[model samples]
Target: MKFKLLAAAVSSIALASPVFADLVLPWMSYRTGPYAVAGIPLADGYADYLTMLNERDGGIGGVPVRLLECETGYNTEKGVECYESTKAEGSLVYHPLSTGITYQLIPKVTADGIALHSMGYGRTSAANGKIFSNIFNYPANYWTAASAGVNYLLNENSGSLEGKHIALLYHNSAYGKEPIRTLEGLSEKHGFELTLIPVDHPGQEQKSQWLQIRRERPDYVIMWGFGVMNQVAIQEAANIRFPMENFIGNWWAGAEHDVIPAGDVANGYKSLVMNDTGSEFSIYDDIQKYVVASGKAAGAGDNLGTVMYNRSLYMAFLTHMAILKAQELAGTSDISQAEMIKGMEALEITDAMMAEYGLANIGPAFSVSCENHGGPGLGAVSQWDASAGKWNLVSDYLVADMDLINPLIQADSLAFAQENNITERCN
Candidate 1:
């Protein structure tokens, strides 16, 4: 597979100083294939943010950043190839945006001694950083998203879901299967009848799944879909005249690209959100001024402020924070992958820090530690208003019930450790 590299020019000051080496950040990007609709904005946001830092702030901690974009086309094999090829380029951290790619890179990244910032899409169990020390999925994970979705439902139904028939229409992949265990546990706890419907890859066709949904008449549908799958599912629901208000999607299913194609029929569809949507934040203004306005933007400037794009911007911001923390701890702008891991583990995002970073009220502030790679696991529900052409937050920040999720994480992480002969690092 051929890899595409996007290298930012080093600052003249850094070029003048022979001792300065750019900090490398490798993006395992996927801007093609079935998921390109979703991938393009995310990749663009990530690259543009790093570009903005380089252009406006002179890079993080005054050290120039070298961001390498290696396209995986959302393919697992290509993702691994990207990682292998870039791992030797003084790579400080890896962000494999695809859940499938993240799964494949877990062991390899661990062995390679680089930090993996899976964010919201990787193994939910990696939230237990004791076993998965080099992996970080802060702010929220799938299990947390699942619980928050259910919590929103419970609130919607007046705090009781007993006997409510809920259908889960998910894409058939590792990413889609993630919420099953959590939803199952929630079903047993709340006395709701759970139905699972799987849509094959690319997710363009889901006639049969919608037929089942029509036959069973589930009171609510929780979508675990991505890319074209999301739009198709929304259209199918509208075709059946299912009440759009009763449908909700996971975070991955809630972007602008998902609902815009369906138009007004997608109105009232809701989804979980770990970050604020739209470009109302100050950071976005900076992005507009420094990146897009200057024509340094990665993709089309039309998607400059959409949900998925902003989400990726937030992801890049958090990654930047971690890198800054790593540099601060090491007392050097240029640090190794091991130092990046230390920075990620010790990273904390407070309210003040969020304001400083121009991210106030975007999401909950949380800290990463040795024992917890994932942050506070906080999320909120956002409803799609097709007429308005944007998403609006309808619920306050909902905290995940760790009481229910923690046990599952413990068991899964323990199993992983035993199978890999790994020991807990911070226990």
Candidate 2:
């Protein structure tokens, strides 16, 4: 009887062993929605990179990663449900990937002591780490992208944009409206006429907006759209014979699926890029060898080198680095959510580290600090080459004018803090 009891106890311990050995990384993904064109590549890239780390390096810092993907369909309600359901599973970090969802989870995550790493597409004010203790929007944010886009246009126009009419065609959503404030501020500062056009969600129909654009004949058109909106906008621009070169899209609007549908008409259409696109990076080879070769690729290996795919890959890599840093700081491979937040806050990605990881010139070097969660707001512009079927870098890395962005971040973040009765940390 004692022997039988011993065997049962051993089995119970074995069953519980796996839980302690793995780290949960919950991914709020959207693979079956209107935005799936952009979502599929991003989900695949994020999952595949994490898979590669597990295969190539036995996970970050020797702790195997458990990637749990709960489809949010890019819906805010679904995203919150996914977070609530998975937060109890010892999730180390959360990447919501939607600004609306990110806004919803900001308070919930902060209360739960979980870190929300928005990467490039969440609350721009979360860049102020002092006001947002549990959130991180590193490398670049929407405001940064907006300022950089304006700066690039100014440079293209030989320093001054006086009397230049710039049209901003944006999706009428939280994500779409992120850049309007900064763009408006820049317009006031530079003496440029700014026209605002809002495209409703799903972004399938843009006929009236394009008709207005054609009638207005703005010198340049800046697009803040995603998914079907991007393709339809490009098609409409082509229909109106707008100069594709003068049409610029924010980072989200420049993916492969976005422009490929427009064919050669997409040629010369420019957009901002925070990281290098395509599978030429050394990490891709490793992914090809370790993950794809072993029949473990996330999305059939077709999206291995696209713009959105590469951006997601970079996001996963940075998150992995943060995990490693957290492990080191905590002196354990298995880290808690708080420890992961500390790791993300103290993380730094340098040029040398990029070169070592075979990501040379792929992304801008940036660091996370106690007071500043957003990294140096650096990005470049890429022009689509439909004939070449690729996006080529068109300009050097342009730094966003923090002079225009800082005050807004302060105002928004401070207001949030005041509303929530939370004290600022870096004051």
Candidate 3:
């Protein structure tokens, strides 16, 4: 299905006069690229939620909300172009799902005074709301996953991680760097030795990264790669007799395409999961009935409830809910970027919302403010059982030992503030 697009550039202001006050959200998606297998469903799920909300609930805050999607194909330049091209039509926020793009457009968002809703999967340090005024990495970040991954290993070893050697095979980019800072901190604090292996972008040919793993003999390997990198990590781990069960992947590294490509060889390899999987979620039923059944589902019925599908849907939901909260505060349908940012800062995803969405709550119960972007460090450890063909949650909504890492976040934020000359003002 071809989604609608507004050709005007974000910086262009061709005033045709505001016909009806509608909230505009511009999306940058990678629907046709190496990451498309994961990107397409996620894009569809995200767009469909906005469409569903508009159709069923009469848009957010009783004002029509339009989602204009521009494909980036995982290209950072294309993402920036799309952002520049879409921001002028009164865009309430820019939700670029790429960590690379987040890094690129972060400064631009601050200059433009528009919000960047980067809830998950971006520079973990961007979670410092004060330093990065316009960038919001809510709910959780990559460092949370890193700390959780370390905690999972410790838990598995019966509550102590003194001499454990943990290896990380990650995509060689800003996104991959998201977890390294926290992992290093965790290692130093917990007395675990850490080894990092970088896999170049698109992450396909990794015969060597795995060889290093074989030689290092890490107690467990954590994967921070995506797309071809994920399957390659699994295959290489399997080839080196590294015991698939012991290898863990960050959220982006674990998905259907990531595993299916490894064929049956990728059984029992575990990864940290951001949310629930499978087509049994109640939201999927609504999508099937309201969107797909009505021939309005973004992509196809087969993509429903997959990892990308759920992630996209979840991201859009968070954005929509933020808008709802913003409207409650703004008390008007014509919500400006500043008002929306205020609403975003005040959002609280209650258990009732989780029940309404047929999604489980994985959290530390969060409310964003101007100073703090991340709500809570809530996440779970999920294991893939080859026999079951499903991700099993091994732990609950556990909070990572933030006390051990907040200092690092602060130090890094300070460094970033100094490097960028970021001046923050709290309301």
Model 2 scores a TM of 0.95
- lDDT accuracy of residue 304 in candidate 1: 79
TM-score of each: 0.95, 0.95, 0.91
In model 3, which regions exceed 4 Å deviation? Answer: 1-19, 360-364
* lDDT, model 1, position 359: 81
Question: What shift in Å separates residue 358 of candidate 1 from its native position after superposition?
Answer: 1.5
Off by over 4 Å in 2: 1-20
lDDT of 2 by residue, 264-321 (tens): 9889999998998877888888898889999999887998899988998888888888
- Estimate the lDDT of model 2: 0.91
Question: Judged by lDDT, which candidate is best?
Answer: 2
Can you give the lDDT of residue 263 in candidate 3?
68
Candidate 3 local accuracy as lDDT?
0.80
Give a tens-digit lDDT track for model 3, residues 126-235.
77787887888888788887887887788889988899898888889777877887888788888989998899977778888877888889989988888888877787
Task: Give the alpha-carbon lDDT of every model.
Answer: 0.90, 0.91, 0.80
